[model samples]
Target chain A: GAGVSQSPSNKVTEKGKDVELRCDPISGHTALYWYRQSLGQGLEFLIYFQGNSAPDKSGLPSDRFSAERTGGSVSTLTIQRTQQEDSAVYLCASSLLLAGGLDTQYFGPGTRLTVL
Target chain B: AQRVTQPEKLLSVFKGAPVELKCNYSYSGSPELFWYVQYSRQRLQLLLRHISRESIKGFTADLNKGETSFHLKKPFAQEEDSAMYYCALSGLANFNKFYFGSGTKLNVKP
Candidate 1:
């Protein structure tokens, strides 16, 4: 892809249901990131995947949220037992991890998830 | 603790007016800071980074360790510059984990 792409631009799910958001990062990018943007709260980092190393999941808000990057190209964010508070925009970004810490993340159009 | 903070939710400026978007971060060690902008209906894109210390589209930001701030500024605003701006930080403590502040929407009116 020319840029980071996200699937299902919008998702409406009932409370307690599970939702999955997908991201396809640019080819050859070594780093991928997931973030959640909501009212009051800013863009919150959820997880990061870089070249097969253990994902940095320190930013995940809770245990219900999890993500996996397959083949280092596509990534999926799964929110289990979704609650109303889960309503927000899920953004995915990718970057070429440079040697000089000059990574400039390119973000996707984001998936707007609404849990009712 | 919230690593990044963007104090203004919205900033309205007239065309040709000076503009400034405030951002602050809290980190013990040196952190990488960046400014990202999202145009209407477009994906978020990097506007600039403190590391590069370069200006883009006439906008610039300086990392102030003394004040713990990285404020985006432009001498004159253009209507096309109206967009959502986010300040971000990547810290050594959470290497590769980037933290973003609540974005400030800049509305440059004609």
Candidate 2:
């Protein structure tokens, strides 16, 4: 009955510091995704994880952006050496399956990350 | 690359008037289109999907392949309908990822 959830609702850090955003997908969801929303870029897909197979890292902006899903449930998005441009709202979503169509994704409240 | 476009950054309408939010997408294959909405102080949630062909909260969107558009429409706008609406597309080729538009902020004035 619970929807997706994210931690660290708000985080403020200095440039060059590392920040981690966590997401807890809904129960039995096999697909998890990370997205960033900001004034400049709008909403951009960062990464996705499906089951235990290899994760899709193509959407990641740079090498500093990385994510990992432990045991196919919880996911952590880590941004190393955070830059001022990395300031945005980090949103997490999950779906029942990874099929190509009609899969409704439920989103979390998102964590607002501010890199000063 | 697939892309979604929302030409209008903001759309304002009077309550009880017709409202339409335009959305256009670029993709080669049959695409799964979705409308997501976020009210003030609320999380993003799915409003409707084209495949389902169902209307939610009196809002409906028709996917036009010829024009590459899927505009959200409601005959009578309500104050509660004001929010940020995003058009998203997931192509069959890249089903794992979704391309979202810049989002249109709808303001319903009474």
Candidate 3:
């Protein structure tokens, strides 16, 4: 079984540019999540999607940080007008359960984004 | 407010020595706790969960509601155990959205 996977293992962009990071969750996993891993910041939850319900964007640091899960499998995190502060590893995860059940979250290899 | 804390950023232990990684959490309601691990060049993966009440790879954690802690421990550390560990919490109040700790990097010397 394929685990959660993120594309563009590494991405380097200029400040003010927009970058899109992709994530492919495990098949049949209804819950998808995005996180940011940075130095001294740990893992910060950016957004979450469960099935068709609205996403939990409370953890998103700013309006520039946005994510979308299409067809309930693939997700994309887009950082608009990227800033130096946005330089971090973007991680994605998926769980087997739905409806708020506590399940193991399989993580992706992460996309290392650098805003130079 | 829901939060997970890992006081130590780094912990070093010798092979065959006992190891403990402390974790504390703050949440208004009952929270499900989990320990995730990441080895070098590996993605983060589940090491254990409080609900499962089981041990994996010679590691175990006891969740204490009274003390608000869930620390991972092992009787004897192995060099292969060296990696990053993260403590995470999820509860109904936050709709099961996990709040993760800053993570602790463990170094086991042989």
Candidate 4:
């Protein structure tokens, strides 16, 4: 079975540009998540989607960051007006379920974004 | 405020020697703990979880609520075990939001 997959392994853009990173979660997985890994920093939660309910956007760092999961499978994280601080590896993960259950999240290769 | 802590950023051990990676977490409610590992050029993957009570690759972790720790331990270290290990915590009430540690890079020398 294919694990979580992400597109555009690497991306480079100038400051103030907008970029979107894509993620294809494992088939049948009901949960999707996005995280950012800055240099020498731990993985920071970004957003989460489960089934068809409202997503948990508490982890999103700023208003410039937004994510959406369509058809409950594919997810996209968009960073508007990119900043030098946004340079990091954007990671996506998925799990079978997350609501009051024990699940392990499988991660994708990640998209390394560089904002110059 | 849920948080996971990995005090050591890097740990070096010799082949065939015992290995221990310390992890501490802070959360008010009951928490589910997990250990994630990423080998060189590999994506992060779950190594083990506290709920499963199973060991993978000779590694085991005992969750201690009293001490608020879930340290990964192995009797003998293998060169293949060298990688980056992250300690993560998920709150019981929250929707499986994982808070990861700073991660520990393990180096095993033969």
- Point to the candidate with the largest TM-score: 4
| TM values, all candidates | 0.94, 0.95, 0.95, 0.96
What local lDDT score does residue B66 receive in model 3, on the 0 to 100 scale?
Answer: 97
In the range A63-101, model 2's lDDT, one tens digit per residue, is: 999899888899999999999999999999998763544
Comparing candidate 1 with candidate 3, which one achieves the higher TM-score?
A: 3
Measured on C-alpha atoms, candidate 3 has an lDDT of 0.90
List where candidate 1 sits over 4 angstroms from the true fold: B92-94
Among residues 3 or more apart in sequence or in different chains, the pairs in candidate 2 whose N, CA or C atoms overlap within 3 Å are: none
Writing each residue's lDDT as its tens digit, candidate 1 over A7-98 gives: 98999999999999999999988888898999766788888889655456778898999898889899999999999988999999988877
Residues B1-110 of candidate 1 have per-residue lDDT tens digits of: 54899999999999999999999999766798989998998988999988788999999999889999999999999999999999988873345678898899999999
Residue B92 lDDT in candidate 2: 50
Output the worst ten-in-a-row residue range by lDDT, candidate 3 chain A: A50-59
**DockQ for candidate 3:** 0.67
**Clashing residue pairs, backbone N/CA/C < 3 A, model 4:** none
Look at candidate 1 and give me any clashing residue pairs: none
Q: Candidates sorted by DockQ, descending order? A: 4, 1, 3, 2
User: How large is the interface RMSD of candidate 2?
Assistant: 2.1
Per-prediction fnat: 0.85, 0.69, 0.72, 0.74
lDDT of each: 0.89, 0.90, 0.90, 0.91
- Pick by lDDT: which candidate is best? 4
lDDT of 1 at B50: 85
**For model 3, how does the per-residue alpha-carbon lDDT over A44-70 read when each residue is reduced to its tens digit?**
888888874545677889999888887
